[model samples]
Target: MAMNLPSQRGRGRKAPMADINVTPLVDVMLVLLIIFMVTAPLLTAGVPVNLPDSLAKPLDQDQKPVQLSIDDQGRLFLENEEVAETDLPQRLERITAIQAGGTPPQVFLRADRQLDYGRVMAVMGELNRAGLNRVALVTVEGTPK
Candidate 1:
Protein backbone atom coordinates (compact mmCIF):
# COMPACT_ATOMS: atom_id res chain seq x y z
CA MET A 1 0.00 0.00 0.00
CA ALA A 2 1.35 3.39 -1.05
CA MET A 3 0.62 6.47 1.17
CA ASN A 4 0.57 10.02 -0.25
CA LEU A 5 2.90 12.50 1.47
CA PRO A 6 2.51 16.31 1.78
CA SER A 7 5.75 16.87 -0.18
CA GLN A 8 4.32 14.92 -3.12
CA ARG A 9 1.21 17.19 -3.45
CA GLY A 10 0.50 18.64 -6.95
CA ARG A 11 1.55 22.31 -7.49
CA GLY A 12 -1.32 22.80 -10.04
CA ARG A 13 -3.87 23.45 -7.25
CA LYS A 14 -5.27 27.03 -7.10
CA ALA A 15 -6.02 29.02 -3.89
CA PRO A 16 -9.68 29.91 -3.10
CA MET A 17 -10.75 33.32 -4.48
CA ALA A 18 -12.63 35.99 -2.47
CA ASP A 19 -16.01 37.31 -3.72
CA ILE A 20 -19.15 38.93 -2.19
CA ASN A 21 -21.84 36.39 -1.46
CA VAL A 22 -25.32 37.66 -2.61
CA THR A 23 -27.38 35.30 -0.42
CA PRO A 24 -27.38 37.81 2.47
CA LEU A 25 -28.23 40.66 0.08
CA VAL A 26 -31.24 38.76 -1.22
CA ASP A 27 -32.38 38.02 2.32
CA VAL A 28 -32.12 41.72 3.30
CA MET A 29 -34.09 42.75 0.23
CA LEU A 30 -36.88 40.32 1.03
CA VAL A 31 -37.02 41.57 4.64
CA LEU A 32 -37.26 45.18 3.48
CA LEU A 33 -40.08 44.29 1.08
CA ILE A 34 -42.05 42.66 3.90
CA ILE A 35 -41.54 45.66 6.21
CA PHE A 36 -42.85 48.07 3.57
CA MET A 37 -45.87 45.87 2.91
CA VAL A 38 -46.76 45.95 6.60
CA THR A 39 -46.31 49.72 7.06
CA ALA A 40 -47.59 51.18 3.79
CA PRO A 41 -51.22 51.23 4.95
CA LEU A 42 -50.29 53.06 8.14
CA LEU A 43 -48.52 55.90 6.31
CA THR A 44 -51.72 57.33 4.84
CA ALA A 45 -52.89 60.65 6.29
CA GLY A 46 -56.38 60.86 7.79
CA VAL A 47 -58.16 60.82 11.10
CA PRO A 48 -59.46 57.43 12.22
CA VAL A 49 -62.94 57.91 10.77
CA ASN A 50 -65.47 55.37 9.64
CA LEU A 51 -66.21 57.48 6.59
CA PRO A 52 -69.61 57.28 5.01
CA ASP A 53 -69.25 55.79 1.54
CA SER A 54 -70.88 56.86 -1.66
CA LEU A 55 -71.06 55.31 -5.12
CA ALA A 56 -69.84 58.56 -6.68
CA LYS A 57 -66.29 58.54 -7.97
CA PRO A 58 -63.65 60.42 -6.03
CA LEU A 59 -63.11 64.03 -7.06
CA ASP A 60 -59.73 65.33 -8.24
CA GLN A 61 -58.94 68.98 -7.57
CA ASP A 62 -56.65 71.10 -9.71
CA GLN A 63 -54.54 72.07 -6.73
CA LYS A 64 -53.81 70.22 -3.50
CA PRO A 65 -56.61 71.11 -1.13
CA VAL A 66 -55.98 72.04 2.49
CA GLN A 67 -56.60 69.14 4.88
CA LEU A 68 -58.48 69.77 8.11
CA SER A 69 -58.86 66.91 10.54
CA ILE A 70 -61.29 66.85 13.47
CA ASP A 71 -60.46 64.14 15.93
CA ASP A 72 -62.75 62.46 18.43
CA GLN A 73 -61.47 64.86 21.05
CA GLY A 74 -62.73 67.75 18.89
CA ARG A 75 -59.19 68.88 18.18
CA LEU A 76 -58.58 70.59 14.86
CA PHE A 77 -55.57 69.85 12.65
CA LEU A 78 -54.69 71.87 9.60
CA GLU A 79 -52.71 69.76 7.16
CA ASN A 80 -51.77 67.32 9.92
CA GLU A 81 -50.47 70.20 12.07
CA GLU A 82 -52.47 70.89 15.22
CA VAL A 83 -54.14 74.31 15.20
CA ALA A 84 -55.53 76.25 18.14
CA GLU A 85 -59.26 76.71 17.66
CA THR A 86 -58.87 80.47 17.95
CA ASP A 87 -56.11 80.53 15.35
CA LEU A 88 -58.10 78.61 12.77
CA PRO A 89 -59.80 81.66 11.33
CA GLN A 90 -56.53 83.56 11.08
CA ARG A 91 -54.80 80.61 9.43
CA LEU A 92 -57.60 80.21 6.92
CA GLU A 93 -57.47 83.90 6.13
CA ARG A 94 -53.76 83.71 5.50
CA ILE A 95 -54.10 80.66 3.30
CA THR A 96 -56.93 82.18 1.32
CA ALA A 97 -55.07 85.46 0.99
CA ILE A 98 -52.19 83.68 -0.76
CA GLN A 99 -54.57 82.19 -3.32
CA ALA A 100 -56.74 85.28 -3.74
CA GLY A 101 -55.48 86.01 -7.24
CA GLY A 102 -55.72 82.37 -8.36
CA THR A 103 -58.63 79.96 -8.07
CA PRO A 104 -60.16 79.79 -4.60
CA PRO A 105 -58.36 77.27 -2.43
CA GLN A 106 -60.43 74.25 -1.49
CA VAL A 107 -60.69 72.87 2.04
CA PHE A 108 -61.10 69.15 2.69
CA LEU A 109 -62.47 68.26 6.13
CA ARG A 110 -61.70 64.86 7.62
CA ALA A 111 -63.75 64.52 10.77
CA ASP A 112 -63.55 61.42 12.93
CA ARG A 113 -66.65 59.26 12.91
CA GLN A 114 -67.04 59.78 16.65
CA LEU A 115 -66.79 63.56 16.41
CA ASP A 116 -69.80 65.74 17.14
CA TYR A 117 -71.69 66.80 14.02
CA GLY A 118 -71.94 70.37 15.32
CA ARG A 119 -68.18 70.64 15.64
CA VAL A 120 -67.69 69.64 12.02
CA MET A 121 -70.36 72.08 10.91
CA ALA A 122 -68.79 74.90 12.91
CA VAL A 123 -65.46 74.37 11.17
CA MET A 124 -67.16 74.43 7.79
CA GLY A 125 -68.95 77.60 8.75
CA GLU A 126 -65.69 79.17 9.81
CA LEU A 127 -64.08 78.33 6.48
CA ASN A 128 -67.07 79.77 4.67
CA ARG A 129 -66.94 82.94 6.74
CA ALA A 130 -63.25 83.19 5.85
CA GLY A 131 -64.28 83.28 2.14
CA LEU A 132 -63.25 79.68 1.42
CA ASN A 133 -66.38 78.17 -0.12
CA ARG A 134 -64.80 75.33 -2.05
CA VAL A 135 -65.09 72.84 0.78
CA ALA A 136 -65.51 69.04 0.64
CA LEU A 137 -65.82 66.19 3.11
CA VAL A 138 -63.21 63.44 3.05
CA THR A 139 -64.52 59.90 3.34
CA VAL A 140 -63.37 56.35 2.75
CA GLU A 141 -64.83 54.24 -0.06
CA GLY A 142 -66.82 51.39 1.41
CA THR A 143 -70.20 50.55 2.85
CA PRO A 144 -70.61 50.93 6.60
CA LYS A 145 -70.40 47.73 8.57
Candidate 2:
Protein backbone atom coordinates (compact mmCIF):
# COMPACT_ATOMS: atom_id res chain seq x y z
CA MET A 1 0.00 0.00 0.00
CA ALA A 2 1.33 3.60 -0.84
CA MET A 3 1.22 6.30 1.96
CA ASN A 4 0.30 9.96 1.24
CA LEU A 5 2.51 12.70 2.83
CA PRO A 6 1.83 16.56 3.13
CA SER A 7 4.32 18.81 1.25
CA GLN A 8 6.25 21.62 3.19
CA ARG A 9 5.75 25.14 1.67
CA GLY A 10 9.45 26.31 1.93
CA ARG A 11 12.60 25.26 3.78
CA GLY A 12 11.61 26.78 7.19
CA ARG A 13 9.36 29.65 8.36
CA LYS A 14 11.07 32.85 9.61
CA ALA A 15 10.97 33.58 13.42
CA PRO A 16 8.71 36.43 14.74
CA MET A 17 10.44 39.86 14.88
CA ALA A 18 11.69 41.31 18.25
CA ASP A 19 12.58 44.86 17.07
CA ILE A 20 10.78 48.01 18.14
CA ASN A 21 8.59 50.10 15.77
CA VAL A 22 10.05 53.55 14.72
CA THR A 23 6.96 55.39 13.45
CA PRO A 24 6.56 57.19 16.81
CA LEU A 25 10.21 58.41 16.77
CA VAL A 26 9.73 60.36 13.51
CA ASP A 27 6.55 61.97 14.88
CA VAL A 28 8.27 63.10 18.10
CA MET A 29 11.19 64.67 16.23
CA LEU A 30 8.88 66.74 14.04
CA VAL A 31 6.96 68.01 17.08
CA LEU A 32 10.18 69.05 18.87
CA LEU A 33 11.37 70.95 15.78
CA ILE A 34 8.15 72.96 15.63
CA ILE A 35 8.27 73.81 19.38
CA PHE A 36 11.83 75.12 19.16
CA MET A 37 11.00 77.29 16.13
CA VAL A 38 8.13 78.93 18.01
CA THR A 39 10.05 79.62 21.30
CA ALA A 40 13.49 80.70 19.97
CA PRO A 41 12.69 84.42 19.80
CA LEU A 42 11.36 84.57 23.38
CA LEU A 43 14.67 83.54 24.97
CA THR A 44 16.67 86.68 24.22
CA ALA A 45 18.27 88.62 27.11
CA GLY A 46 17.84 92.29 28.16
CA VAL A 47 14.52 94.07 28.56
CA PRO A 48 13.28 96.24 25.69
CA VAL A 49 14.24 99.90 26.20
CA ASN A 50 14.56 102.97 24.05
CA LEU A 51 18.33 103.25 24.60
CA PRO A 52 20.18 106.43 23.66
CA ASP A 53 22.15 106.28 20.43
CA SER A 54 25.87 106.80 20.37
CA LEU A 55 28.57 106.83 17.72
CA ALA A 56 30.91 104.80 19.99
CA LYS A 57 31.45 101.09 19.31
CA PRO A 58 30.21 98.53 21.81
CA LEU A 59 32.76 97.56 24.42
CA ASP A 60 34.12 94.02 24.14
CA GLN A 61 35.12 91.98 27.15
CA ASP A 62 36.20 88.44 27.94
CA GLN A 63 33.33 87.73 30.34
CA LYS A 64 29.87 89.31 30.30
CA PRO A 65 29.41 91.87 33.10
CA VAL A 66 26.71 91.94 35.75
CA GLN A 67 23.86 94.12 34.46
CA LEU A 68 22.49 97.08 36.44
CA SER A 69 19.53 99.13 35.33
CA ILE A 70 18.19 102.56 36.36
CA ASP A 71 14.63 103.21 35.31
CA ASP A 72 13.02 106.57 34.50
CA GLN A 73 11.66 106.83 38.03
CA GLY A 74 15.23 106.77 39.43
CA ARG A 75 14.81 103.26 40.77
CA LEU A 76 17.95 101.13 40.91
CA PHE A 77 18.08 97.41 40.21
CA LEU A 78 20.87 94.89 40.30
CA GLU A 79 19.96 92.01 38.03
CA ASN A 80 16.28 92.85 38.65
CA GLU A 81 16.64 93.12 42.42
CA GLU A 82 15.46 96.40 43.84
CA VAL A 83 18.41 97.98 45.65
CA ALA A 84 18.54 101.36 47.33
CA GLU A 85 21.03 103.85 45.93
CA THR A 86 22.73 104.19 49.31
CA ASP A 87 23.38 100.42 49.44
CA LEU A 88 24.90 100.09 46.00
CA PRO A 89 28.48 100.80 47.07
CA GLN A 90 28.31 98.31 49.91
CA ARG A 91 26.84 95.64 47.64
CA LEU A 92 29.52 96.23 45.03
CA GLU A 93 32.26 96.17 47.64
CA ARG A 94 31.01 92.87 49.01
CA ILE A 95 30.96 91.39 45.51
CA THR A 96 34.52 92.55 44.88
CA ALA A 97 35.71 91.25 48.24
CA ILE A 98 34.50 87.74 47.40
CA GLN A 99 36.59 87.64 44.23
CA ALA A 100 39.15 84.86 44.11
CA GLY A 101 42.73 86.10 43.75
CA GLY A 102 41.63 89.74 43.53
CA THR A 103 39.76 89.53 40.22
CA PRO A 104 37.19 92.33 40.15
CA PRO A 105 33.73 91.74 38.75
CA GLN A 106 32.81 93.66 35.59
CA VAL A 107 29.75 95.92 35.91
CA PHE A 108 27.62 97.18 33.05
CA LEU A 109 25.27 100.13 33.46
CA ARG A 110 21.97 100.61 31.63
CA ALA A 111 20.11 103.89 32.13
CA ASP A 112 16.73 104.78 30.73
CA ARG A 113 16.64 107.43 27.97
CA GLN A 114 14.62 109.83 30.14
CA LEU A 115 16.66 109.28 33.31
CA ASP A 116 18.76 112.12 34.66
CA TYR A 117 22.43 112.02 33.67
CA GLY A 118 23.36 113.08 37.21
CA ARG A 119 21.84 109.88 38.64
CA VAL A 120 23.72 107.80 36.11
CA MET A 121 26.97 109.59 36.97
CA ALA A 122 26.37 109.09 40.66
CA VAL A 123 26.00 105.36 40.14
CA MET A 124 29.23 105.30 38.15
CA GLY A 125 30.99 107.23 40.87
CA GLU A 126 29.80 104.77 43.52
CA LEU A 127 31.11 101.85 41.48
CA ASN A 128 34.39 103.65 41.05
CA ARG A 129 34.64 104.29 44.76
CA ALA A 130 34.19 100.56 45.31
CA GLY A 131 37.34 99.95 43.20
CA LEU A 132 35.39 98.39 40.33
CA ASN A 133 36.84 100.07 37.25
CA ARG A 134 35.70 97.64 34.59
CA VAL A 135 32.44 99.34 33.67
CA ALA A 136 30.76 100.07 30.33
CA LEU A 137 27.61 101.91 29.28
CA VAL A 138 24.96 99.82 27.52
CA THR A 139 23.13 101.30 24.51
CA VAL A 140 21.08 100.28 21.51
CA GLU A 141 22.41 100.58 17.98
CA GLY A 142 20.89 103.44 15.99
CA THR A 143 19.61 103.46 12.43
CA PRO A 144 21.74 104.92 9.67
CA LYS A 145 21.04 108.62 9.07
Candidate 3:
Protein backbone atom coordinates (compact mmCIF):
# COMPACT_ATOMS: atom_id res chain seq x y z
CA MET A 1 0.00 0.00 0.00
CA ALA A 2 1.65 3.31 -1.12
CA MET A 3 0.71 6.43 0.87
CA ASN A 4 -0.09 9.58 -1.28
CA LEU A 5 2.58 12.32 -0.62
CA PRO A 6 2.61 15.95 -1.95
CA SER A 7 5.36 16.78 -4.48
CA GLN A 8 8.29 18.77 -2.92
CA ARG A 9 8.68 20.97 -6.12
CA GLY A 10 5.29 22.70 -5.57
CA ARG A 11 6.10 23.44 -1.95
CA GLY A 12 9.45 25.09 -2.82
CA ARG A 13 7.95 27.54 -5.46
CA LYS A 14 6.97 31.03 -4.19
CA ALA A 15 4.84 33.87 -5.79
CA PRO A 16 6.79 36.60 -7.67
CA MET A 17 7.64 39.68 -5.66
CA ALA A 18 5.36 42.64 -6.63
CA ASP A 19 6.58 45.35 -4.24
CA ILE A 20 8.91 48.12 -5.46
CA ASN A 21 12.40 48.38 -3.97
CA VAL A 22 13.02 51.95 -2.67
CA THR A 23 16.18 51.59 -0.58
CA PRO A 24 18.55 52.30 -3.49
CA LEU A 25 16.43 55.20 -4.68
CA VAL A 26 16.41 56.73 -1.22
CA ASP A 27 20.18 56.34 -0.95
CA VAL A 28 20.74 58.07 -4.32
CA MET A 29 18.45 60.95 -3.33
CA LEU A 30 20.28 61.43 -0.02
CA VAL A 31 23.66 61.50 -1.80
CA LEU A 32 22.46 64.15 -4.24
CA LEU A 33 21.07 66.27 -1.41
CA ILE A 34 24.39 66.13 0.44
CA ILE A 35 26.34 67.04 -2.72
CA PHE A 36 24.18 70.09 -3.35
CA MET A 37 24.37 71.22 0.25
CA VAL A 38 28.16 71.04 0.23
CA THR A 39 28.63 72.87 -3.09
CA ALA A 40 25.92 75.52 -2.73
CA PRO A 41 28.04 77.79 -0.48
CA LEU A 42 31.09 77.46 -2.72
CA LEU A 43 29.14 78.74 -5.74
CA THR A 44 28.43 82.10 -4.06
CA ALA A 45 31.92 82.49 -2.57
CA GLY A 46 33.40 84.09 -5.70
CA VAL A 47 36.20 86.71 -5.69
CA PRO A 48 36.41 87.49 -2.00
CA VAL A 49 36.22 91.19 -1.18
CA ASN A 50 35.19 93.25 1.79
CA LEU A 51 31.87 94.54 0.50
CA PRO A 52 30.49 97.80 1.87
CA ASP A 53 27.67 97.54 4.35
CA SER A 54 24.22 98.77 3.32
CA LEU A 55 20.72 98.71 4.78
CA ALA A 56 19.10 97.88 1.45
CA LYS A 57 17.03 94.83 0.58
CA PRO A 58 18.25 92.29 -1.97
CA LEU A 59 16.82 92.41 -5.47
CA ASP A 60 14.42 89.81 -6.90
CA GLN A 61 16.04 88.42 -10.03
CA ASP A 62 14.44 86.53 -12.88
CA GLN A 63 17.83 85.23 -14.07
CA LYS A 64 21.38 84.74 -12.88
CA PRO A 65 23.10 88.11 -12.66
CA VAL A 66 26.53 88.66 -14.18
CA GLN A 67 29.18 88.91 -11.43
CA LEU A 68 31.57 91.84 -11.91
CA SER A 69 34.05 92.23 -9.08
CA ILE A 70 36.50 95.06 -8.35
CA ASP A 71 39.19 94.18 -5.89
CA ASP A 72 40.87 96.59 -3.47
CA GLN A 73 43.67 97.10 -5.98
CA GLY A 74 41.07 98.12 -8.60
CA ARG A 75 41.59 94.90 -10.52
CA LEU A 76 38.56 93.84 -12.51
CA PHE A 77 37.06 90.36 -12.61
CA LEU A 78 34.20 89.31 -14.81
CA GLU A 79 32.44 86.21 -13.49
CA ASN A 80 35.58 85.41 -11.47
CA GLU A 81 37.79 85.63 -14.59
CA GLU A 82 40.26 88.49 -14.94
CA VAL A 83 39.49 90.80 -17.86
CA ALA A 84 41.43 93.76 -19.19
CA GLU A 85 39.82 97.18 -19.11
CA THR A 86 39.93 97.42 -22.91
CA ASP A 87 38.40 93.94 -23.34
CA LEU A 88 35.49 94.53 -20.97
CA PRO A 89 33.26 96.27 -23.51
CA GLN A 90 33.78 93.56 -26.14
CA ARG A 91 33.09 90.79 -23.61
CA LEU A 92 29.95 92.54 -22.43
CA GLU A 93 28.83 92.93 -26.02
CA ARG A 94 29.35 89.26 -26.69
CA ILE A 95 27.33 88.32 -23.61
CA THR A 96 24.43 90.54 -24.71
CA ALA A 97 24.72 89.68 -28.41
CA ILE A 98 23.59 86.16 -27.63
CA GLN A 99 20.07 87.43 -26.97
CA ALA A 100 18.90 89.72 -29.74
CA GLY A 101 16.50 92.53 -28.70
CA GLY A 102 15.96 90.91 -25.33
CA THR A 103 16.54 92.90 -22.16
CA PRO A 104 20.20 93.11 -21.23
CA PRO A 105 21.36 90.84 -18.41
CA GLN A 106 21.59 92.29 -14.93
CA VAL A 107 25.14 92.90 -13.59
CA PHE A 108 26.01 92.62 -9.91
CA LEU A 109 28.98 94.93 -9.27
CA ARG A 110 30.91 93.85 -6.21
CA ALA A 111 33.53 96.40 -5.23
CA ASP A 112 35.81 96.20 -2.24
CA ARG A 113 34.96 98.45 0.66
CA GLN A 114 38.30 100.22 0.21
CA LEU A 115 37.89 100.72 -3.54
CA ASP A 116 37.95 104.32 -4.73
CA TYR A 117 34.69 105.85 -5.87
CA GLY A 118 36.33 107.01 -9.11
CA ARG A 119 37.50 103.52 -9.97
CA VAL A 120 34.05 102.07 -9.34
CA MET A 121 32.51 104.81 -11.45
CA ALA A 122 34.94 104.11 -14.27
CA VAL A 123 33.91 100.46 -14.30
CA MET A 124 30.28 101.52 -14.20
CA GLY A 125 30.98 103.83 -17.13
CA GLU A 126 32.39 100.94 -19.06
CA LEU A 127 29.29 98.87 -18.22
CA ASN A 128 27.07 101.68 -19.45
CA ARG A 129 28.99 101.94 -22.70
CA ALA A 130 28.51 98.22 -23.22
CA GLY A 131 24.68 98.69 -23.02
CA LEU A 132 24.55 96.90 -19.66
CA ASN A 133 22.30 99.38 -17.88
CA ARG A 134 20.66 97.06 -15.40
CA VAL A 135 23.48 97.20 -12.88
CA ALA A 136 23.14 96.59 -9.14
CA LEU A 137 25.88 97.51 -6.67
CA VAL A 138 26.33 94.51 -4.42
CA THR A 139 26.77 95.18 -0.72
CA VAL A 140 26.72 93.28 2.53
CA GLU A 141 23.78 93.58 4.88
CA GLY A 142 24.48 96.11 7.66
CA THR A 143 23.15 96.22 11.19
CA PRO A 144 20.66 98.97 11.94
CA LYS A 145 21.93 101.77 14.19
lDDT of each: 0.84, 0.79, 0.88
What would the TM-score be for candidate 3 when compared with the true structure?
Answer: 0.78
Q: Cα deviation in Å at residue 143, candidate 1?
A: 2.7
Please give the TM-score that candidate 2 achieves against the real structure: 0.71
Decide which is better by lDDT, 1 or 2: 1
lDDT of 1 at 102: 85
What TM-score does model 1 achieve against the real structure? 0.69
lDDT of 1 at 18: 75
- Which candidate do you rate higher for lDDT, 1 or 3? 3
Backbone-clash count (model 1): 0
* All candidates: TM-score: 0.69, 0.71, 0.78
Model 1: how far residue 105 lies from native, Å: 4.1
- Candidate 1 weakest ten by summed lDDT: 3-12
Judged by lDDT relative to the true structure, which candidate is superior, 2 or 3? 3
Alpha carbon lDDT at 138, candidate 3: 92
